[model samples]
Target: MKMNHGFSWQYDEFKQVGTDYGSKAEVEIYDSSHADFRDMEAESIRILDSLEIKRSNVLIDFGSGTGTFAIQAARRCARVYAVDVSRAMIDRAEAKAIKAGTSNIEFHHAGFLTYEHNDSPVDAVVTTFAFHHLPDFWKGIALKRVNSMLKPGGQLYIHDVILEETNAVENIAALIDKLATAGGKLLREDTERHFRDEYSTYDWVMDGLLSRSGFTIKSKHIEGGVLGTYICTKN
Candidate 1:
């Protein structure tokens, strides 16, 4: 994938947002810290199965942290293009892919607004916990770009921190408390920083973005009013 230079007013997706994934130290402890809350392997398997990924399909994974989901997807698919903005994260992910002996996965140090997919349209595009880096306007633009990268009726799976309009504040606090209980101080502070600084928007806004950007939402699920998952198909 090539990197596209946008207009001067365009959002700088490569810039470090709320979380400094550019830090090598942060990259090192990412999996361990997230493991306390998320089962990456199991989540990857579940998502792959839900998407009906096949041996002959090609897919793109945006914000492919540490290559966990990319490696798992490569095992079941023909090829996986794993992309990230942070060079540190990409380095770690590439190293993990090599260690796992997965050669079908390609690592690209790019982000939502800059990554230019030149190959034939892919079967699916998956992004997890990364879309919030972009503000809502740029998010809509990014989704349009993602739509162009996919084949007709291609799938898109997005999992991120999204909020419900009602009880948004209380839900976020409860979610933070839950993370703190599960992963201690590190998780608590992390969650706080995410909501405090990131661009997580209401569910209605996300739905509007997807729909107006050329997708039909197949399924939308929100857990505990903080995490959102959407399975959509290109229209």
Candidate 2:
């Protein structure tokens, strides 16, 4: 699918829907259906081990969907910044944080790519399943922003879909599984619509982002082998 620079979804609309997707969507996608997106797909095991949270370290979950990850990070991380573009998402994240009884978390309802933060003291910038939404040109720009947010020598532990470099068929079961889950209906439709709308040229549910972006590709933790965690080091 070819991505159009101006063919981005209405930011507000997309985010509002995304915010409502709490643990239910995340857990279901990973557990019962879409085996590729299974909880293991988030690369939690690898992320947990690769994470270097400490007494004084600070971490940020860029585009934190519903705070599930933020809550988990707060347990071990001294502090965590959960930033998302949707106000709804931020509210849910904050609510989740409160429910989880985590005090070290700071929630921001702003686009991480454009949000301003002067204190770039974080040890690592953890971005999971967010970068792919960026407009064509901004993918690189977004990476630079995340890179800048990291302290010198900090790490970037990202876990997102690693699109195949070649054109291969998608699993039909993944499509069927989406129809059975809580938010699967919309997720499945939108996901397919997105691929259909965008994958005509330079991309189309293809994998090339992480590989094309030079960040010193480090370790990748795999689940179904198609989905995995990528841990990178900053120069």
Candidate 3:
């Protein structure tokens, strides 16, 4: 994937922040590890349904980990662009796509800051648990780029660890405790590390970023005060 020739001080997204997804071992265990808590296929179908994806539309999955959503989306859309920062993740996703007999997905080893969409504007852009890879400033910049990649009135869906200002500390503690009970020490530590190192921001900040980047927030949903989902349309 060709990178943008931006300022010299651009953030190096390839150098992962919290989890070392670049490691092949991490990539190998991602699916099983996440399966303990998430029904990825069901969640993907719900997202596709929420977007109202049509058979003729094109969609982009920004953090297409392991091709779960990408393959599912490919079955419903004309084409799917699966983009990720880790080459190992991309390779694993590609292998799974092949195994699933999904041929419409185009895998790209790129992140939000580095991905370049050369084709025509896509119908929608979907990302989950991925946007926090960048700090708030870079997230704003990345949203502007995402805005440029969509058609007029196209949709954008974001699901990530966004917080609420009220009882933020207690909420995070509760979330960590919940993860620990659900997936034991491994997931508990992962959740702790995410909050400590990742750049998850407040819901108000995310709303402002989407609005400033030319998106109209159609719907906003926050679960457990830590997980957030925003469905937006290009302005």
Candidate 4:
């Protein structure tokens, strides 16, 4: 087993590269006519479908990563606020919206756990592969903030990559990912700047956050592996 070297390299050598990878990936899609969001487009569609975002309500995507979720969700939601910590990611997301001629989406560059705005209430808060990178306390605080940010009966869904339910050929799949991304757009950086957040975080913290925040743990959908999607609604 070669291990998830691509993920490991990201966790150990290109800090904040998760945000960077997302931003650059959109650049790839924008520059090439035949460029697709790859499998992510399908994955986003599937996940949002599971979330069931309402067309009459507002939805906010936390750490929205180039607006993949935001864009798909706009069809059903009145507006989609795409929030990200990196300006580069926010910029790419805006570019994609313009290219698509969509007017229902907006981009905001803001940290995941540090967003201070609570004025524009949203009906749902969605995050994927982002919460898995925070420690327990931060995850809890984030859920609390999100819960407080939503309108009554508002929904919150956190999707992540877990280690246990990962597919058997995960290592091989990762190797393929490495080869496919090789030189395509590597986040050239030293170890101190890698995806350290994910390497240092886990999913149980999120589960605990839901419990402690008094969020109604409604459902769990394991999509990619043992690490799947968890739906928790605030009461």
Of models 2 and 4, which has the larger TM-score? 4
Give per-residue CA lDDT, model 4, range 57-166, as digits (tens).
89888877667778888867798888877666678778878887789987776655556655576778888756655555556656777887787777788776543333
Cα lDDT tens digits, model 3, 1-235, are 2346777888999998999889999899898888878899999999999999999999999988888999999999999999999999999999999999999999998889889999999999999999999999999989999999999999999999999999999999999998898889989989999999999999999999999999999999989999999999999
Provide the global lDDT of candidate 1 against the true structure: 0.93
Better of 3 and 4 by TM-score: 3
Write down the lDDT that model 3 would get.
Answer: 0.93
Where is model 3 more than 4 Å wrong at Cα?
1-3
Mark the regions of model 4 whose C-alpha exceeds 4 Å error after superposition. Answer: 1-38, 165-202, 223-226
TM-scores of all candidate predictions against the true structure: 0.97, 0.70, 0.98, 0.71
Candidate 1 lDDT over residue span 158-218, tens digit each: 9999999889999999999999999999999999999989899999999999999999999
lDDT of each: 0.93, 0.59, 0.93, 0.63
Pairs clashing in candidate 1? Answer: none
lDDT of 2 by residue, 75-187 (tens): 87688888877565677668767888899898876664556665656788887766555655556556666766777677888665444334323532354355446455655
TM-score-best of 1 and 2: 1
What lDDT is reached at residue 36 by model 4?
Answer: 23
